[model samples]
Target: MATTSDNQLRNPPLSDQARDRLRAAILEGELKPGDKINIERVAETFGISRTPIREALKALETEGLVQIQANRGAIVEPQVWQEIHHRYRMRSLLEGYAAELSCGKRDKKLIAALQDNWAQVKKAGQAKTVSQNSARSIAELNRSFHRMIWVGSGSMTLVRFLEALDLPQSFNDAFYKEQNARQVVCEHHGAIVDAFIEGDTAKASTLMERHVLDSVDLLASQADDHVSNLCC
Candidate 1:
């Protein structure tokens, strides 16, 4: 049997901690897209060794949050609007099917859970001002709300596929920051839940697909604005 030291060596706590910290930094926009990550600087900031930071970057790379270059350090991956649009299209398809399947199941527990989550979503939306923290809070609640539907679909394969197509938190952050975003989300989510209540699978699926696709326009606008800012 492997000893304690072996397990510790294989899974070092420092690496995991560094990875989490770095991930938060990236997702929170502290490390903007295209920002170069200097390993030495990060190591000093975290008061850890460079090895864990390197390992952390490797992990983030698999998550599509960063690209590591040979002989050079890593840089945050730029959010290409075209690629994001494609991802949303795929999400609409998979998540739409998930909603249909979930509705067909008529899982009362799932419905209740969605309702509860939606309440939290509305509460978060009631914030007086939109800030990064509030946006993050809403994004997390939004994720939980959708994830319940994914699980309710009763198909692990579908869940895995949906998870694979998931975008980084930064996109969600931007979406929630837009004007009338909270109102839009509340309306869509409330309608989706009502569709579920009436056991309307088609309506549920259609609403879910539209709900996802609708965000594409807002996000595209955000991307255009970002480009404009950079150009000017």
Candidate 2:
């Protein structure tokens, strides 16, 4: 898995790495809706060239994370409640199916690994390491947990399609930021583990669906409150 480095994230070019960071920031609400991203300023801040920044912005344009105006450069787009709902629907359908297939088939080794990741999430959250490393560790654990379940389903095509679905517009990342959200998500992981252990495919699928949808609702509600404060 070739990935952009954290150094790249901190000192980015207008490349995919920069695009990912900017997108993460927007989704995380560090850069809010209607905020303008000055390409020159961002370039200077990240110590990168404008070329990669422009390129990254273009990539984000396709993902609906940022909108580029003829004269306005890049601006964060306002995400409506409905669209967020729709995104979760897609996630639920895809990941739920994966969970269903995963039941009774998940490699024990993989489950243990996921368990380890959850422990890390707990440790990082307790340590109050809210910096990028802590955040990334948490996010990566979450991703690994889901991906392992999905991959265990043995549906390569489904896994590929779900991968294409990619990260939602910063929604889950936002949920991870909330103090209570961490505990909720970890407990949700526990629920998922229980279902898997029982070899109850239906239960696993239902839990996955509810877990994901609950997250959507939680994040959307928080986003509403945050946006309200910004408006004030």
Candidate 3:
């Protein structure tokens, strides 16, 4: 149904940058979950036209970060607590399996790559707080870490399935911005990496499951703190 001109207009590399930027806005809470994104405003902000913005938003939609409408603009996907639980539940299963498979590969080069990305994740956690600007870099490192595991597993099928399970960082960004919470996350990353390095498949799987669930627990705790503050 589409014309060749329409296909030619799409720029994937540029659109990918836009997608990452928009996703960061959602993750940093600059664009709250369930909020509508203005295409024109985003175009102005990024100096790109609506076509690329649409492309990027559409891409993010596939990743569960935003939802697009025909009549309206894109909406940052709403994340209910139950939805969060479900997402993490799926992540625990798929990522745990990915980690388990990756550990079995026993590839030293791949292990080093994973370690390098994990170190970046650890370093990024040092910021006293996460902001719209800072979240992009951290997200990049986090993405790399997860992608390495998927690739290391050497299962294209597993990698494809795991692609959709990216954490809605918007939910946990504030929690991770806190010093104590950030430290705990860093420790978890370290332990997981250690498992991979030692080729401990079982430990990797268990740690991955715990790490995914821990995020949900942290978000719930943050929500409770907000409620208590209101009550007080």
lDDT of 3 by residue, 46-127 (tens): 8888898889988888867787888877787877355557877988888899899989988899888878877887887787
How do all models score by TM-score?
0.69, 0.76, 0.62
Q: Candidate 1 at residue 19, lDDT?
A: 78
The segments of candidate 2 whose C-alpha lies over 4 angstroms from its true place after superposition are: 1-13, 80-84, 104-132, 168-177, 221-232
User: What stretches of model 3 exceed 4 Å from their correct place?
Assistant: 1-79, 168-176, 223-232
lDDT of 1 by residue, 1-232 (tens): 8556877867668987787777656544456677778888888888989999999989888877788998767887776344457778999999999999999998898999989889888888876578998898899999998999999999999999999877566667767876577878988999999999999999999999999998776555454443211110
Across residues 1-232, which tens digit of lDDT does each residue of candidate 2 receive?
9998999867655497778767656655566777788777777766789898889888887877677898777777766345547777888988999998888685677667766877777776764437655566677788888888888889898889878766743445555667677778888888888787677889989999998888877765565454312111
Instruction: Indicate which candidate wins on TM-score.
Output: 2
lDDT of each: 0.80, 0.74, 0.73
Segments of candidate 1 deviating more than 4 angstroms: 1-12, 78-86, 130-140, 164-181, 213-232
Model 2: residue 18 alpha-carbon error in angstroms? 1.6
Ranking by TM-score: 2, 1, 3
Clashes of each: 0, 2, 0
Point to the candidate with the largest lDDT.
1
